[model samples]
Target: MANTREIKNRIESVQQTRKITNAMYLIASTKLRKARNDLANTRPYFDALRGEIKRVFRTAGDVDSPYFYPPDNNTPLEGTYGCLVITADKGLAGVYNQNVIKEAEKLLAQHPDTKLYVVGEYGRRYFDQHRIPIEHSFLYTAQNPTLDRAREISALLLDGFLTGTLKEIFVVYTDMESSLLSEAKSTRLLPFHRMQFTPPAKEKAVQEPFEFYPSVGAVLNSMIPSYVSGFLYSALLDSFCSEQNARMTAMDAANQNAEELLSALRLQYNRVRQAAITQEITEISAGAAAQRRTFGSEG
Candidate 1:
């Protein structure tokens, strides 16, 4: 049992800690809400870009577009794949970073020869711990993500895909479903999937040929990269929001625990002080009684 003095000091410390944790939790909760709204607003644009490119691929060229179709099956086994792993720069969220790292590890194991690209410090640390060779990595993405960062990352992946250095490129990240739920997702970024979106069965391409200002190929080249940018941006946004939510959730738990500890300490402090006072009172009363008896007997 700790002395009242020591326990009192501990109670004060925990109170201070609780205050800080509460503040952090509130801030994180607010940020998570905002991030979700931001991502939702841009989802339509991303969808439109994706739909436009896929539709273009269906009718773009007389010959098959190289980007639309799969290349030789043997190429993937022989060609290196670039994996972009997204994880928190710092981790406090429950299992968010861990889940992403696990998924990335599984993806990496599928390819014996791969060019690993690490995006954040956490992911980089994970690969280093596993002794996986990282061919390229970026460590400077802002705590609050930006579109330019996504563009740069997308461009790098596109370059690898075009150069034949990487037959496939994938982004492994956490997809934010909500404050409490974020799922790890591994998605292939290139070569772009050609999904054909056609008009209604009653309508035909000949009935209403969509006009391309330059050409479908040219239009697709621009839109596809934009679509990629949006996807990567969404991942980063999801991760940032998830990190905040996790931190907030953890801090809230810590704060509650601290409050409980403080309550226990206060109760003990009061009991100990009351016991000391009662003991002093009993001793004084007994001493006075003994003096009264001694004096009376002597007289």
Candidate 2:
């Protein structure tokens, strides 16, 4: 009976766990859908801005801009580096936070003189627990990534780079390749490299000479800030989407495991119950036989 009671308690616990996990799964699914829509809406704009920047650099001959390259070639080996790490604020997301934190650690290892700017609580906690100093941390931004928030983060990084406080800047986050897949990736956000752009084929319409509002360099200078903000925003969206997807998958798995455990526990409980019933029947029969033997002796 005790064993049966314990099993019953376990069954109840599993059921409650399953309920929580199933609810979490549904919530994550809803968040993932919203994140996906947000990503779809902003991705094209960012892509276009990026492409235009590259095109300008390609066609505009002999352009010089502070945004195009690092301040100097002779950056000291011990120069401080800036790392922006994006992670989920909450846990139970199946390594979504760990991957980004690990990637950030790798960057920190490479550049020991680093100022950390974290975008989530998880990374901040990990770094704090490890005794790593964080220069800045933005909370509640990952859940709802916006252009204004991206610009705010970009401003900090840009100021550090331009002022020679940080020699280079890197952003570490998890990228959502698909609903089922997420991968950690790092992108250098500073010391921009000029991309090699190929001209369109002759079959395409001949492009005309384009004129910038002021000059190509000036236009680039003006656009670089917004471009960086857009890039960061895109990364934030990807990381947010990845987190949701990971949470959904984790909760789904937990629910399934709970169901399996409940099944096994139920079977054990049934067997124990059958054994108890059989023992009771045996005891009753033996008592009746003893009474009948006493009656025969009396006669």
Candidate 3:
């Protein structure tokens, strides 16, 4: 059994830790709320952008645009696969970063000729430490996702796609289903797949015959980049929200564990203190009895 002083110190240490964890939990909660709001607010615009792209693909038939359909099945997979990995900049987010990295690793292992384009400091540092080759690294972009930032990343990716450097592109990120549930997922971003677009019976294409100012291909070229940026930006926001949610959950658990530890330490301290006091009382009683006997004998 530890002495009262030792147990008291342990209790104080746990209390301090509890305070830190509680503060972190509160911080994460606030950030999570903001991230959720931002994600929700941008979702509509993202959906509209995707809808417009799909509509364009549906309207423009037999246009030899690479962005309209998936890569040719007959074409052998020979080019390097580009993977954009999204992770958090800091730790203390539980398994948030690890899960996404593991997902990316699995995908990369399947394709030996792959290049990593990491977003966030954590992923970049992790890959560098592991001696993995990084094609490009973007830092400090995941937390505050914006159109401009997304555009920058899109430009790089689009250039690679246009140059045939990246045969296929995919984004590995954490998809947040809810506050308590999130899963790391890999989504193909390039070699755009054809999605079946259904329109309302009331809204017919003949009723709204659209004419392109320059050409359909020119319009598509502009729309494709914007659409890609929006998609990537949405992924960034989802990842940010997931990171906050994970951190909040982890901190809440840590705070609870600290409370339990503090309770046990306090109980130990009380037991040790009571034992010391009882021993002191026993010694005092024995000394008094001996003194009283000696005095009576002498008298």
How do the predictions measure up, each by TM-score? 0.86, 0.91, 0.92
lDDT of 1 by residue, 23-127 (tens): 888888888888878888988988888666546644543423444444323233457788888887876666778998888888878987778887788888878
Off by over 4 Å in 3: 70-76, 196-208
lDDT, model 3, position 229 = 90
RMSD, one per candidate, in order: 3.0, 2.7, 2.3
Q: Who is ahead in TM-score, 1 or 3?
A: 3
TM-score of 1: 0.86
Residue 11 of model 1, lDDT score: 88
Model 2: which residue pairs collide?
none
In candidate 3, the residue pairs with backbone N, CA or C atoms under 3 Å apart (3 or more residues apart, or in different chains) clash, namely: none
Using lDDT as the measure, name the better of candidate 2 and candidate 3.
2
Write the residue-wise lDDT of candidate 3 on 159-240 in tens digits: 9988999888899999999776899999988776554333454555643656876887788778878888988888888898
Q: How accurate locally, in lDDT, is each candidate?
A: 0.77, 0.83, 0.83
Off by over 4 Å in 1: 57-63, 71-78, 196-206, 211-215
lDDT of 2 at 176: 90
Task: Give the candidate order by descending TM-score.
Answer: 3, 2, 1
